[model samples]
Target: MIEQSRLVTPVLGFAGFSGSGKTTLLEAVIPHLKSSGLRVGLMKHSHHDIEPDKPTKDSYRLRYAGSDQLLLATSKRHMLFFEYRDNEERDPQLRECLAQLDHSRLDIVLVEGFRNETLPKIEIHRPSYVKPTLFPHDPHIIAVAYDQKPDALDEFNLPSLDLNQPSDIAGFIKHWLANAPESEKYLAYELKL
Candidate 1:
């Protein structure tokens, strides 16, 4: 499935433990990417439940009343809400959500928080303050975006980037996206979640 996805759109992931600058980096990278004329699609999985609906909205009321899927469309745009009716539906597979993205109109799909998914990912590392690095375990991680270079970096020989410079990271992403398919051979190393 991942091989099939690569033929259509390049998918990259930003993964790190909480407070390791994953979100901080993307906020800057997205604008740089957009300014560079690339149409980017982003998918983020939140550990916390989010409330995008207000209590007074009809969509909220309908969902609250037991609607499974509610799509509110307007002249400008539309929002589709998929309410998970079962325990299995509550958390969806990353591949399923990736398919839903309009890849034909996108240059790349940036995924956040789907660490367990089999894809090329930049592992954001902050050694001085952050927890242990994940690259030692996850082979899906292609490179490191860090605040300080740790000793383990030599062991892995993975490309490293400074976390403080988002532009550099963005450039790294552009380069990685261009060559992501070449790294597919490492897919055999993917750890089963």
Candidate 2:
């Protein structure tokens, strides 16, 4: 059997501070998208240094010995370990990471963080934080999720999703995916109402 690649995978982003339900929303949304028969890919961004391989492990030792990238695989799972070179000046761009995926097989890409990146995002806000809303000047903010009614803001026209009900939020995302222009390829696999 020959494998075919998908033409496009619309990227969706979620951004918020720690403990603001960003991961919670993703946990609910990913299963919903998969149950609808769409192959979903996820990418999480973190500013702190990450160690996927432990220091005492062989992979970690090999990496320290100077391998640029490491591929570890078992019968059921695989992981790619990448080490940045000292002379490397630039970091990978969001699109570059997206391009590295086998998009031909995926229906969508859900990203967490990268708030400053130019991409469509759903901002998760907590009323208690008392922070400024992201939609006022960010055209890329497609929606907002909040625990309570947000104070009136005239600059943004985007809809708001309730953070209390994960199902409702998932439903809203499903609706958006169904109506979005890039949804053509996955329309056939869309969930029936």
Candidate 3:
């Protein structure tokens, strides 16, 4: 039997400060997207150091032997490890990493950070954090997911979504994707531009 190819996969992003509800919103939306017959890919950006290779793992040994990147897969799981030089930044180029996704099988890629990228994003916010609203200044911010009413936010003209309502948020994403321009559809929107 021939394998079915995926339709266009739009990229969505979630951006917020530390302790904001970015992950919380993702936890809610991913399952809903999957249920709707869409295959989803996820990428998270982190500033901290990450050790993808444990000292005893074969992948680690390969990296220690001076391999630049290592790929490990089993029947159930797959992981990639890229060795970095000391003092180098840990994160890889977002676009380059995203390009490695199997677009043939994915309908969407939900990115959890990289606030500066030009993709449409839901800015998770909490009033107590007192951070400036991203939507006011950044046209790329498509919505705001907040935990409480932001009294200082009445002047902004963006959609304000409830952080706790994952179903509703999922509905919003579905609607947006359904209506998005054909040329604009796909994962890594900003990268395309």
Candidate 4:
């Protein structure tokens, strides 16, 4: 049987400083998005190294035994691990990561930590943190989600979101998905120059 082609899906990102609650908001918003019949795929970028397979597990041992790539599969889910050379170890490109998702199963892709990438994103800001706001300089920031409105909020024309409410954020995402440009709705294979 021929493999099914991946669907073109919109990519939406959450961007913020480390403690600004990007993950927490996503944790809450995902279920809300899912409830509305969206199949969401997430791609995260991290500064630290990650080891999802335990040292004691066969998969980990096999990986250490020189497998360049490994897939751990079970009835419920699966995970793929790829080993990189020291020189090859660097922050992954957003387009490269986007290419990895099985898009046929997703309606949209939600991203975390690619704050600097040129993609449509919701800026999560906490006024109490006194951290610099990204919306001022990032044209890719389409909206701001905050616990309290920033003093500079009125200066911009962007929509503001209440960080404390996931349902409202989900509503905003649903609306965005509906209106996103066809160029932005497609996957990264088309993103490549």
The candidate scoring highest on lDDT is 4
lDDT-best of 1 and 3: 1
Clashing pairs in 2: 5-104, 6-104
Query: Candidate 1, clashing residue pairs?
Result: none
Q: How high is each candidate's TM-score?
A: 0.85, 0.82, 0.85, 0.91
Q: Tens digit of lDDT per residue, candidate 4, span 86-154?
A: 666677888777766777798889999899998889999998988999999998888999999988888
Each candidate's number of clashing pairs is: 0, 2, 0, 0
lDDT per model vs. reference: 0.79, 0.74, 0.77, 0.86
Ranking by TM-score: 4, 3, 1, 2
Error of 1 at 94 (Å): 0.3
Q: By TM-score, who's the top model here?
A: 4
Give the range where candidate 4 is weakest over 10 consecutive residues by summed lDDT: 184-193
Error of 1 at 142 (Å): 1.2
Runs with alpha carbons beyond 4 Å of true place in candidate 1: 1-6, 87-89, 182-193
Question: What value does the lDDT take at residue 97 in candidate 1?
Answer: 73
Runs with alpha carbons beyond 4 Å of true place in candidate 3 = 1-8, 152-154, 187-193
Superposed by TM-score, candidate 3 places the C-alpha of residue 114 at a distance from the truth, in angstroms, of: 0.5
Could you tell me the TM-score of candidate 1? 0.85
Which scores greater on lDDT, model 1 or model 2? 1
RMSD of each: 4.9, 6.3, 4.8, 3.3
Q: Which tens-of-lDDT digit does each residue in 1-193 have in candidate 2? A: 3233334577888977776778888897778778878798888877666787789999889998999878887899778877788875555567656655666677778889888877778889887887776777677778899987677543466788888777777777778777866643231212211
Tens-place lDDT per residue, model 1, 1-193, is: 2333344567788888888888888998899898888998888888787779899999999998999889888999777788886756367677667666666688888888888778888998888765999889999888899988977988998999888888888888777766656555222222122
In model 2, where is the ten-residue run with the lowest total lDDT? 184-193
